[model samples]
Target: MTFVVPVHQQGQQQTTSEVGILNNDLSLEREGALGLLERRRNEVVNRDLNTSTTAVQRNQEENGDDENAKKKQQRSQCSRGCKKDWLGDGWCDSACNTEACGFDEGDCLGWCSGDCKPSWEGDGYCDAACYVAACNWDRGDCSRWREQGVDAVERRALQQKLRQFQQHRLQLPECKCERRLLVNGSCTPECNVPECLFDGGECLDMCNAKCSKSWLGDGDCDRECDTPECAYDKGDCASTTNATLQAMRKENGTLEVCDSTCRLWMIGNGVCDKQCNNAACGYDNGDCDNITAVVEIDYSVEPEAVYQFCAKEWIGDGHCDANCYNKPSRWDGGDCEGTEFEVEQAAKGIGPQYDQ
Candidate 1:
């Protein structure tokens, strides 16, 4: 039988055990190759990380050095400031280091003999030798000395002329409305306003008389203020002189008259019902008290308003029972009416509340 099998045929007829052994060898080789590739990748990644970290650290160190250098330069500059100033003791640094609120060049020039003035570059009064541009030079005291030193009489004349010129130039709008300004937690104006029938401020127009300003502060004004509510007056308003509001029904009709002292109600009426329960009434207000609001009047008539009762049925507003009051009011005597009541009665009982 002595038969020798061909190599190709032997390979084709390989047993299961042989096939398993070859597969194991191939897997081992594959694993070894993969391990080598992973090792190379890890080395490259580590090298990149080290390079990046070194670059970052170097940049941070350089930034720190630059910051230090800048601070050193600033210090040197400040040292020179001490010699530059008149006192020769101050650093170049201004009062406000933060340029946002920095001072002007002549801010700390010398000791201010009078009121400390703002820098020469600001808009304020120059109480010191150096100060900012004085914006108020358009008129007033500065106007007289606009060019040079002048005598008092000449200066006064120049100031008056300048003021007149400015007034002529600045005219009020046709719409007569009051304007307001802010100052010292209060809305005060720039000029002195006298008291008349208006507040102590400059009148916008010639519609009202100029008030005599005795007080410097601001107050309400109404040129035609016939009653308590002070209407807005374009002109300067004046404070009340006597601290008493005089109201009267007119001479012919029952309309309130001005000749008599301020009265509350007409006597000849039905169901007189008057009450005092408001803040101004001095009746029951928690905070307001019954202080004697005395008023000086010229009329020789015996005061009757201080002791009269309210005519309930004759009250201007039908709701007078709830609001109309009569207390011992010095101004109106006894029959003092509230603002609402006054307006209603003045309009002959025609008002919002009465209509409603």
Candidate 2:
């Protein structure tokens, strides 16, 4: 019988034609090769597109990362009398619990019983480890912290201090130190000042004055202090040694300082002039509420500084004659005495003002 197939139908039949038994494997291989060729062509196109987009996309991603980092940093600081939140409980305290007492239910747990600042608590910036810092104490078991591996003299000194503190504990009007039967003295194992036996004669003060650096007079008490360039209002004395915070020994209540400079106190109204040398300070608003105000200044001399006024009483802001006097530069001829000012730096030219 003769087959009468249409042309389109014939082409369909050819496309759907079955392969011979062994040819099935061959057909699959052939299809795979063709698919591989098409895939290679698509891969070439995709590779070009990927290369073109790589740099731009990478830059965009980097910019996004930087922005994220900046935001994270801003949120990280503890500004509201608290910290950036505790990792577990998210609570903050004023002093940062210098001893990050590992607390569970508001009770000190773990190894330390007292206010032992744990090594991992707070920011851990105060992680003194075995050293045992009182202010910024963190990290490690404070129980193990002590002047260890010392000879007879060193060990005896520690024992002496323990005895002294024990005696001191007895005299406390309040906060009484209870003696535990097992312990020898108060502050059972406290990290008190070192009273080691030093060797040789060392300096007492800078000028061989009172109070040697030596705790035991052996000469090894190393307490080198910083010499202050100027004095603060604390007493106007020249602070030759570096003590963190206190008044100078220069004088008491003189409007003028030996160096005519004042240290910044967070709780006071007295302040210093920040030199306009800071580029960031030029257009800056000098808006200060008591706390954020800048009063402690690094002393500098300039044109405007000469004519500056420290207070209403002070003739000028620390710039005047060596005698700490100033003649009226633009006298309206009013018979008024010159005002006294704190003298950080006295101006030059003692000659009378001819203009006056």
Best by TM-score: 1
Q: What would the per-residue lDDT of candidate 2 be over residues 1-356, giving only the tens digit for each residue?
A: 99786899878766666545448889899999999999999999999999879978999999999977864554444233324343224222222333332222233334232223233333312112212344323332222233342222233444464466567764323212222311232211111212211111111111112222112122232222111110121122223112212332232233123222332221121222343212222111121212122323333442111112223233333433222233432121222235232212123333344324
- How many clashes (backbone N, Cα, C below 3 Å) per candidate? 32, 17
Question: Model 1: runs farther than 4 Å from truth?
Answer: 1-17, 80-92, 95-356
Q: What TM-score, over all chains together, does every model reach? A: 0.25, 0.17
What's the CA RMSD for each of the models?
Answer: 21.1, 21.9
Model 2: CA > 4 A from native: 1-106, 111-113, 117-124, 127-287, 290-356
lDDT of each residue in 1-356, candidate 1, tens digit only: 89897998777668666989999999999999999999999999999999999999999999999977865554445433332332223222233232222222233344231112222212222111122123233223233234433222222343354356346865223212222221112212221121110122122211123322211112444334211111122112322321222221222233222223322321211112123223233222111232222223222362211122333333433344322332322223323246454554456753343533
